[model samples]
Target: MAKRRITQETFDDAVRENMEEFEMNPEDALRDAVEQFESQGVDLTCIVKAVPAVSSDDKQEEQTHEVLKALDSLRIGKDSAAVADVTADMKCFTEQCSVGFAQRYLAAQKDAYPTILSYCKKSVEEQDSVLTALSALAALTDGQPDLLDAEGQQFLLDVLKKHQADSSVTCVAICVVRHCCLKHEQNRQDLVKGGLLPLLTRAITQHSGCAELIKQASSALRVMTFDDDVRVTFGNAHEHAKMIVLEHNGLKILIDSATAHPNNTSVLSELCATLARLAVRNEFCQDICDLGGLKLIMTLLADSYESAVVYNNNNKELVRQVLSAIRAIAGNDDVKDAVVSAGGVELIVIAMNRHMTNPTVCEQGCACLSVLALRKPNNCKAIMENGGAFAAVQAMKAHSDAINVQKQACMLLRNLVARMHNYSQPILEMGAEVLIAQAVQTHQDCGDVGKAALRDLGCQVELRELWTGKHGSLAN
Candidate 1:
């Protein structure tokens, strides 16, 4: 049977009743409340289970800390609140939440979710209060996704629906939605069912000129396409991905947005990442290629690298995201050749060589090459000739401890040798055999792929047998 649970308000009311009516001490009251609830089979996991002190002289209530006190201040009748008071209280709550996770976790434990949610619901009509209240909610829900109940999800969708034309409000609302949907599967489902796809795509189309809004909207759209919730085993991530592309024209909107933000690397990076997320189907991958996505991505890749001379760190991320998008789009066979024909192989090799120290860039770079060389023997020769083979070997050596880099390098080596046997000897001459052996020895997950690469490169690999064909059980 499911366990019975009580709200923080109910438990606090019980503790107060024990102290004020029964003349019990604070400790005794707390103990009595705990024992009573446990005896009634009520779960106290989420309840704060504490009593605040009362100032007898002024009859004012004292909370555990300033954040709780601020939350308490906002709990008064919503209609009686002056605009100035609401603004100040929201700022205080938001500032406290911004300090650290300790304050945010405490506020969440003390039922601050409903209080701030109520403020958001009430302040929807007033523009200033709406942004202020939404900002507070955003800060509060940062690391506390569980606090986003169904009502909170509905409120977020309603905010987007009413304020779709208002860029400022829509940006803040999308920020909150991103916070809630990340790592929370149910919120993603609830929001999607509430018609979130069209709103997000429309926001991107309407605010294509606004870089900040575009980034936020693109990120929220990507979050919908993630299967990242830990509590639930299965999610409709693929369904959501398809919905975004097929039903909402997410491909065109994102591509157009990326085209609009030529100088803004951050916006371009986000759009590229979203593009990767939406390319879950073969047709979608072809659609991306059909929609001039390949040309746009190649342009962004070159532009971001050139701009990296001043901002290396920021542009490194852009490079990684762009490479990831390239890898995703290259899942199609025809697009694979298109990428190579458009100087993608040389550019990708250059990007990998430049960002050799960044493991993610190297990983994405090798994965992209592996996909490009999957069935095309000509492409494998191209990768080997353009210093692609040398780049992969150096990436493996530079970030030897990075398992993803090692795994992708192994896959790339295997793909290169899987079709053409001559290139393996040249690749093995680069001392790749030692790296493949080391990866197999260090990472258990890399055993199969590493061994396959070794075997394809004309190196000896041990084969293990675990099953005997003679029926029954091993014990028998």
Candidate 2:
């Protein structure tokens, strides 16, 4: 037989016969009959109204319950299948969920953080559990670190103290500390004063063989000592950060680590940054020199510009730290001579030209040059010969908003004019006087420096009398 065609009546007749034979529901028979028609050439959009629906609110409520259950699994001294399941869910939430989910979950789990802390606090021997707990804590506190309560704060410090021997634990603890103190100044002070500074240095010493651990410790130190306020904020009578420089032997630790591993530029950069942070005060600067910290930094800088190692770009940050540390150390005349002797002047000039747009580099470079030029005729001659005057003024104009750069440039120019012999002629040739006036007219903070520079050049500043009391820029 060729082909047999079935009408809608015939298909319905067959479906009804089958349904009666099978005792199927009449609705199921009709629906299956319609699906058979659709298999050929049917547009079901007109035939179907909608499919069955599930409640998203129900799913969300269930998920919320799961989160709550997970949090509950994190009770103190608890390590079971439930704890692992909760950890897995928390990991997923931290990694894949949104901030809304995090906030909601965190709000629901009133005791999760402390309980997790307590759970891990006793399991120092179980590195994996401790690591998991720490990672979970990090995820939970990423953007919500301010949610860390006083107990949680002390709990973290205790974790560090308890697990200081384990490099992995130390690494996690440092990461936790870094995120906690990143923008929270008071917390940073509390942790440091609580003896975290000395602990960091000791870790640096103990974990010299572990690159990752050292890197983590160095990074934590850098973050803690990063800000200007943190640099000056001491924890004890040791005058705050000076404890790091003096009492804790932080300077020596950094120097030794950098020397031990020359290729680890990340560690070197962070370590140098920590040193720079502590090198703010004169005693710290002198300490840096005494401990040969300056030499270490200068070597790192020279290496960045001269290294053939396949990863030279890694040293740019090291160069930045070196410049900043040198600027601070150069405040003293003895150290200034040492910097000049180390060819720091040429390096600063090169860095200035290389990083013409980086305001921090320019600021520190100019400040270092200014300090090197103070009361030193030969160093002034070096700066003048290397076109430092041109670089300084250009930096001032380029970053008019950078008060530090402007002040340093003004001071450098002032020293070049007043301290150096016959330096006024080159400054005039370099068109520095106009920049000086512009610097003063523009920056009220550095106006006195600008006017002093102008006067040193023997140029009658437009506001000559304003510098004394009528106007004040800033102290030299």
Candidate 3:
């Protein structure tokens, strides 16, 4: 049976009922409410699950929650508010918004978007309040991308332009840009046109030593390359990505940044992911190689293997990002040979084996091998000899529910035998056919690629004919 669900208000009311009517304490009430809901198979992950605390007052004034109180403190009845007042109000709103999604949502419902945006506009001329205002705006738009409209986009770009030299301000400003452009296509395009790319790349170059600033700027640059807005038919993601690489010299900047911060896993991971996003063309792929990106990536991948015994989340994420970078840069035919020669194939197999439980790592590992095996018979030989094929099949078996893993495994198996048909029997011996068939049956997105893999492996595939007759006969 499907699990039941409840709204945050309903769950909070139940907790409040236990506390008020039954004379239970807050902790006991919350615990009882949780136990009761979960016992009935209700999901409470979205519920705040905490009793709202009201502010104390000397008089008999109405009680208000923390977020509401913080929001109310921002409405000063003056054209030119004091700097201290503005700073204090901004800090309070930022603190409340940073607590959780519930606070941010409540503030948004109370029309916090325009209120905070007004402060952003007002702070444009007041450099003293730039950081705090930008920080508050960043927090307010964390999961609320729709709050960013044309005016907010202009404000963010203005902040980036004004505070380009100040790493502290640029860091928070770029964070705001990242939040706004995350899933908003128009905002991304407008900001990019407003010269956000140059500011972001410049921030990285000027603040190479500042790990936090570099990480935030790198993430913002990557956000520009995303095509995530679902309402539009197409976005300028490819154009933005190429602009970052070609016009802004993004490849060399990121590579140099990674070289500078070799020991910082988080910064390196962001740099690597951004590099993967910017490698849109064949020459760009080669540019990464010529800029010494391959050696840097290989070194990072090797270093990650050393910490395999005490594998943690950061290590897992770093490995995933590095492998994705390798997969993306290997799109070039010459780079494919280079990767195989540099022991990349073996390292990928080991990464898959080490982080076997992580579906994302497995997905990237299989995808890296798939790219390496494309049209290169010698690389295919290297993969199978180094247990790449076996590891991919194992990843498929282990992460059967991961559609990306299944798809990449099928692509890798097909790429293995596409040029070197002799490798088909060996791969099929590892049960590739069964997994591909299962993927085809389970995931609708995996139908074409999975069946192609099976067909190449000499397994029977029932090719369906959805229509017959001339090409444009349906129009008639």
- By lDDT, the better pick of 1 and 3 is 1
Task: Please write out the lDDT profile of model 1 over residues 234-256, one tens digit for every residue.
Answer: 99899999999989999998998
Weakest 10 consecutive residues of candidate 1 by summed lDDT: 55-64
Error of 1 at 247 (Å): 0.8
Candidate 3 residue runs with Cα over 4 Å from true position: 1-49, 57-60, 77-80, 86-89, 121-128, 470-476
lDDT of 3 at 412: 95
State which candidate has the highest TM-score.
3
Candidate 3 residue-wise lDDT, 1-476, digit = tens: 87898866688788879988999998999899999999999977545656666667543555455766777777652246744576766787899889887778778877888887777777666666777778888898887888888888877877787877788888998888888888889888888888889999999999899999999999998999898999878999999999998899999999999877878889999999999999889999999999999999998999997855798888899999999999998999999999999999999999999999999999999999999999899999999999999999999899999999999999999999988999899988998888889999999999999989988888899999887875775664
TM-score of every candidate relative to the true structure? 0.86, 0.73, 0.88
Q: List ranges where model 1 is wrong by over 4 Å.
A: 1-64, 77-79, 471-476
Question: Could you give the C-alpha RMSD of every candidate to the true structure, in order shown?
Answer: 6.9, 15.7, 3.5
Q: Clash pairs of candidate 2?
A: 234-240, 448-473
Clashing pairs in 1: none
Residue 312's lDDT in candidate 1: 68
Tell me model 2's lDDT, rounded to 2 decimals: 0.70
- Candidate 2 on 131-248: residue-level lDDT in tens? 8777767666654556566776777788778878888888878777876776666677788767788788888898887777777777777666545333445433235466666677
User: Which candidate, 1 or 3, would have the higher TM-score against the true structure?
Assistant: 3
Candidate 3's displacement at residue 209, Å, is 0.5
